[model samples]
Target: MYFIPNENLDPTLNLAMEQYILSGLNLDEEILFFFIDRPSIIVGRHQNTIDEINLDYVKAQDIQVVRRLSGGGSVYHDLGNLCFSFILPFPNQPVPDFSSFTEPVIRALRTMGVPAEKSGRNDILVEGAKISGNAYYHNKFGTVCHGTLLFNTDLTVLARALNPKPEKLSAKGVQSVRSRVTNLNGYLPGIKTTVEFRERLLSEIARDAKTIELSDADLANAEGIADERYRNPLWTFGTSPKYTLKRTRRFPIGEIELRIEVRDNIIRDVVFFGDFFTSQEIDPIVDALRGSELETGALTAALRSIDWKAWFPTIQEEDFAAFVAQGD
Candidate 1:
């Protein structure tokens, strides 16, 4: 196996690099890649971004939100987190075996005195508390099994940034996100920093592995890929599947209810019902939103373009836009 080093802190570029490596490279032996991203939220491919994250908090905290190629629940990443991926040739088996990929990491953790065990389908837990969440993507070229290791992650920000559905939390029998997760820091007695822990883990996984460094041309290509897809809002938010959103907010004037139907992240239909007084026709408001993209900026601009004061004189366009788009 060979190891590739990714020192970039940008999550979008990191994902782009992963794509470049997975599809662009012609590989014979397996490849191991590791990286750490600055504060960011990476959502699953099939998940609705509006439902998975606290949009207002994510925006206010200046956290980059990117959708990954794999399918899994959303996860928060910071400098304290370490991410690892293994790119291997397609196996001949009928089903993808996750244990084969996660066993090595679990063994490495156990060797380090951390009681790590594979939990459920794609999670690694320590003492029944989750420390790692994993997902994978397979293509004609190969399969990429990747996951996050919470070396010393910020549980506070993670809990605040992730907005898992109430049913999801209830099904897990956990009250809060922080209650179900733990950092590896408590288990490692001597490891002081995530960097040091990363090196230690790497040594255990591939001590004799060859190292591959990215060339300038490779980086430029990855950056182009990042610009084309990873950094594009269309790919990050617009790729969501068709869904209906019903949001009700109570203002001082009255109670407002909005039922929006979105397909491919574009609003297809919108219905407004409320006790609020209106001096103008409501058709224009619904028309303005029907074709708008279900994103913060797009929804806000669509609402601001119309004379909202003529409808709800007490409500602000920005606030209503946030409510409509974020579903918070």
Candidate 2:
């Protein structure tokens, strides 16, 4: 692991750095890098960005949003959170799996006196609280597994930034999302400052990196990729398709009537004309939903499979689906 303190801190440039290191690094040698960025919302590779972020809250705070090459739920990052990426060579396997790749970083955290462990499907937990979550991308050449360490992130800001409302499409750690989650500072209070946390982590992980610097060519290539896609809306929002649906359905506890739009067969825009405390951004699912084909069943059938009874126990999937499936 090597400390790559980035002077060029724009998220657009940083994402390009990750892409460059993952693709250009010498895979024969194991390399881990420590990265820090300004406030940004990173969306998963397959996730609908519109559904993940609270755009109004983000714009008001001047936070930048970037789509990563890997897939997972959206995560908020600031200098307070330390991000790490591991690029490993996949030899005979020719590709990386979730288990083998993430182990190194998990083990590293244990050395940091954090007692972090892998829990659920793809998360690293500290004392049953998730301190780090990760996702990956793999090719025949190698794999890049990157994740974040919430050492001392502004939790109140993170909560407001992530704002897990609507109770729909949050498949990862449904329980944690609906409840109170903590940052690492709660566990390691002494290292409360973000810079101190970053340095300590860098000192621990630096033992693994061969300590090579990026050449001018590498920086140029990274900047080129960032300019081409990282800065473009077409590569970002345009990647998601659009669809719409509308219906009226009711439940014993609550009810809804909605006209929705979907893209790429996923909920993109949703407008609830009925009574619900849903956030206004549900419009993305409704508006983008037009002409959208169900990945399975009409809106009602798909909704039934989701056990919202646990979270929004008062709401019924049928009513929500009716509103979702109505328009198209």
Candidate 3:
């Protein structure tokens, strides 16, 4: 095992660095890196960015929001927070799981007198309150397990920055969007500061581990990746799989709430729920929309093929196509 020092503090660059290392690792190599982001919220790969965050609040705060390549819930990061990432080679078949990858963190915190344990799905809790949240991304080269450790994070900002929609949380079986989290700063009163805690954790993990440095080529590759993916809006916000696209149009009858699920450039399913009155059932129109492509041209063509006017007499086919083409 080897320790790689953190060279950048930008959330986008650090995420890109993680991807570069995880994808470029050799089969026999294992590396650990520690970093901190300057006030950011990282959304999971499969999460709906529009649902996970309050855009107005985020823009008002000027907090950086980036999407990670891993699958997990969104997390808030600040200068006071410390993040850890591990890239371990799995030469044999590796069943991607959280408990095994979180061992080092559990051990390190336990050594620091904090009773940290792997809690429900992907969190590390201390005395029933969470201190860490983790996620994983795997490739043939290696597996990367990265997570956030709230050492001395600002709870107020953490609360305000993350605005997960209540309905979406309930859909995931989460009771509340607010996390029952605690900071390591309060738990380790003996430790003077967050820097001391970081060093102590490093000491626990870096024992007998080689120290390595990122070469110029590695930095260049990471920078390229950051520019191409992390800093790009398409990747950060446009890649969310699950989003509720709602279109409300007032007709002579009543209002229509056209909610749809568009994923992988395909319209997977849609539900037209509203107080509008219809003589004929809208099941056929809804059935026709299933598995339809998301592009405006393709969708317009598909809608033209269907006689939707009979079901939604007041709403035109163009309006339906336009509504379907609303979101990213």
Per candidate, the number of residue pairs that clash is 0, 42, 0
Query: Which candidate has the top score in TM-score?
Result: 1
Candidate 3 minimal-lDDT segment of 10 residues: 272-281
Q: Candidate 2: which stretches are off by over 4 Å?
A: 1-7, 25-27, 89-94, 163-178, 206-208, 239-328
TM-score of each predicted structure versus truth: 0.73, 0.68, 0.71
List where candidate 1 sits over 4 angstroms from the true fold: 91-95, 239-328
How high a TM-score does candidate 2 get?
0.68
lDDT of 2 by residue, 3-79 (tens): 34555667788888877776775546656766777988887654456756777998899988888776556788887
**Predictions ranked by TM-score, top down?**
1, 3, 2
Name the lDDT value of residue 147 in candidate 1.
Answer: 92
lDDT of 3: 0.75
Clashing pairs in 1: none
Cα lDDT for residue 12, model 2? 81
* lDDT digits (tens) for residues 1-328 of candidate 1: 9898878999999998988887776667888999899999998764567777899999999999998877667899999999999888644323246797889999999999999999876789999899998887766667788899999999999999999766556656899898999999999979999889989999999999999888899899999999999999988787433349988765654345677888899999876544332334478888889899988899889988888886667888888888999976
- The local lDDT score (0 to 100) that residue 278 gets in candidate 1 is 38
